[model samples]
Target: MKARTALLVLIVALLGYLAFFNFSTLAQDVPMSLGFTEVHGPLGLVMLALYALMAAIFLAYVIAMQATWLLEVRAHNKALQAQRELAEKAEISRFTELRGALDDKQTQWEKRVMERLDALENHLKARAEESDNVHAAYLGQLEEQLRNQPGKESPPALGQQ
Candidate 1:
């Protein structure tokens, strides 16, 4: 739509310029009214200047629109990048938290294992001491019985007379 409007404006300006420069030739066929006046020197120059001004204004508008589009695209990309960084940081923090919890569990398990091992060692040592004491008491009783027995006595043969 904008292209068609620009083309129409250009065609109108070209026809006006032709009519202004060759007024006598164009007027030969068409009847002129009292109100119609031919465009002359200063008026034609002013029209041309106005046409140039309109073209410049259109060009400036196009440039401004393009600049605004580029700026908006840059801003969108920056926002996307910031969101990605935030997600990555959140993932890293989650991993760290999980690792810390795992380490804590491992330490607790190790402590419980050491405590059980210490208790088993103490129980076995006590049992060994009890067995040694029982053996010593039995040996003392055997020696006392032997000493109380007689040292000499008459003995009978198989078929004693």
Candidate 2:
């Protein structure tokens, strides 16, 4: 399935074919020297045995590497998940705090606007009262002047005219 696996299979098939064809040569005895002793053995079989051992060792190493990598990736994923949760909580907290601040500002603005309106209403009422008093005084002076001058039929009173 994988390139390395395919190549390994190819190599193994070629060796099997070679060994099958050369059975006589592989069976012939040859002297082999171990570091501790010397012995006569089938050289081809000995070489095949060594190759098998090396393949087993390589397979074991590959399995170990794959397992270690998987565990490291799992740990990294867990850490990322935790970080994501923390970030979401912080974002929610900021949104809530901002909402509270905006509400407070809106309330303050409403209070200030109401206070301004009340002050303006009071000022307009005072001005209207002052204008009424001034008009009344002018009418009283006109009436007094008419009385002192004796009868020129006095002009009609203010509203009556």
Candidate 3:
């Protein structure tokens, strides 16, 4: 695998650097450093090769991790979207049911209102008829009284009354 190869290369370079640099001797500025005796040249090439391999390995790992995390997020988001859609549908259905019930109630209320109005209209018509009959009877009584009054100045002529 590329990852394994890169890891191996990195290890080799790191070891080479340790042998050549001899950090302990360098830090103390010791004469004839251990690194010079141990590494025996070629230090730069060894270190470079190892560092390149390590970089490759780390890059691959990071890319794989990023891809995996991306996929998981996408799947989770999809699931949430599905759930949201279902909830929306349920809410819509509930609203529709409520709307239907309200419509039915409104229709019933309108019917009752119309029926009451009709009853009131009929009652008013009857009352009007009764009033007309009472008025006619009163007129007849007045006419008879006038006729019986004989020659009392002819009971004041028309508009004179």
Candidate 4:
């Protein structure tokens, strides 16, 4: 138990022990004033009974308040747990969406790269073919020029040699 509550219990126990041991003194009659009128009663016992009644009422109130607070705490905890779960789910969803987006971007990039490579390959092949044609044309012109020389014997044509 908490220190304060333990102390309160100890005090109540001592008071109860005192009251039990001095029952006769407590029961002795005495004069008392009711706010409205004067009366005679066992003054000590009456005071003790009133104190007990007040203690009982206060204790009941304390117990009820504590019970209400406990219930409120439980409800708040449940609400917090639910919110935490929702946040986790949302985070998971965002991650999944990001993953999908990345996958799509990678796929598009790969496709574009492949297309670019294919275009480049085609362009290179066309350039190589054009170069070969130009080389053949130059060879033909050289052979003709050599054959047409006026005073020099044309050496046997290039490939024939």
Candidate 5:
């Protein structure tokens, strides 16, 4: 279906056709020398088998490398996730600390305001008491003067004409 797959299939077909056409030559026995003995086998078929074995080995190597790469990528992603979690935790801790400081500052400000209000109330109370004392002394002096006047029998009532 895909272009690369089609190309591979075409190449295999061509090779197969060539092999089939040369079947008799491929089947012809040839002498092969081992270290201690001589053997006979089809040379073309042996060569084809060796090529297939090498191709299989190469494919295995590629699969092993791909597996290794996948493992490394997974490890890297895990490390990155861990770092992100640590950063988030640190940020939350910083936020909590800042919030606590702000709350403490607010409490102190409220306490100061309350103290100032109490001081003002006490000052006002003291001034009112002093005014009351001065008024009472002035009234006492007026009463004594009225009693000492020789012609006055008694002081007139406040509402009398």
Candidate 6:
């Protein structure tokens, strides 16, 4: 059992014992006064009744405080759960934003790479065309020279007269 419960039981038992011990005296009639009137009652019993009334009020106050504390704790837990949910949503949004940004960057990088590759292909094609033109011109010039020197006899082979 809880310490508070134990202490409350002990106090109640002590009060009961005291009241029982004074029961004989409490049976004797005495005079009591209120502001508006006077009454006759057993003095010990009146005092015991008053003590019981005060104990009841004190117990009620304690119960009220405990109920208030429980309500506050419940409210606090609800607020904490809300905050956690909010944080989770925020984190998910952040991740989504980051993912979108990465995708955009990846797309841009791919576009740039494709454009560079196209430019390189065009440049290489142009270079190949220029090389072919130069080769064709050189062959044409050699054929013309051969036609002009036909009457002078073709040049001998390297090992022949």
lDDT of 4 at 104: 100
Off by over 4 Å in 2: 1-24, 27-41, 135-151, 155-161
Best by lDDT: 4
lDDT of 4 at 75: 100
Error in Å for residue 149 of model 2: 6.3
What lDDT, from 0 to 1, does candidate 4 have? 0.95
Q: Arrange candidates by lDDT, highest first: which order?
A: 4, 2, 6, 5, 3, 1
For candidate 2, lDDT tens digit of each residue in 1-161? 99988998999999999999998998899988998999999989989888989989999999999999999999999999999999999999999999999999999999999999999989989988988988888888988787567657777666676
lDDT of 1 at 136: 67
Candidate 2 vs 4: which has more lDDT: 4
Q: What is the alpha-carbon RMSD of candidate 6 to the true structure?
A: 5.5
Model 4 residue 127 lDDT?
98
List clashing residue pairs in candidate 1: none
What does candidate 6's lDDT look like per residue over 103-158, in tens digits?
99999999999999999999999999999999887876775676568567655543
| Candidate scoring better on lDDT of 1 and 4 | 4
**Backbone clashes under 3 angstroms, per model:** 0, 0, 0, 0, 0, 0
**Residue-by-residue lDDT tens digits, candidate 4, 64-122:** 99999999999999999999999999999999999999999999999999999999999
Q: Model 3: per-residue lDDT, tens digit, 1-161?
A: 69988997798688767756875543443233365464344444545577769878988998999999999999999999999999999999999999999999999999999999999999999999988988877776786688678676445534457
Identify the superior model by lDDT, candidate 2 or candidate 5: 2
The TM-score, computed over Cα atoms with residue i paired to residue i, of candidate 4 is 0.68
Q: lDDT for each of the candidates?
A: 0.74, 0.91, 0.78, 0.95, 0.88, 0.88
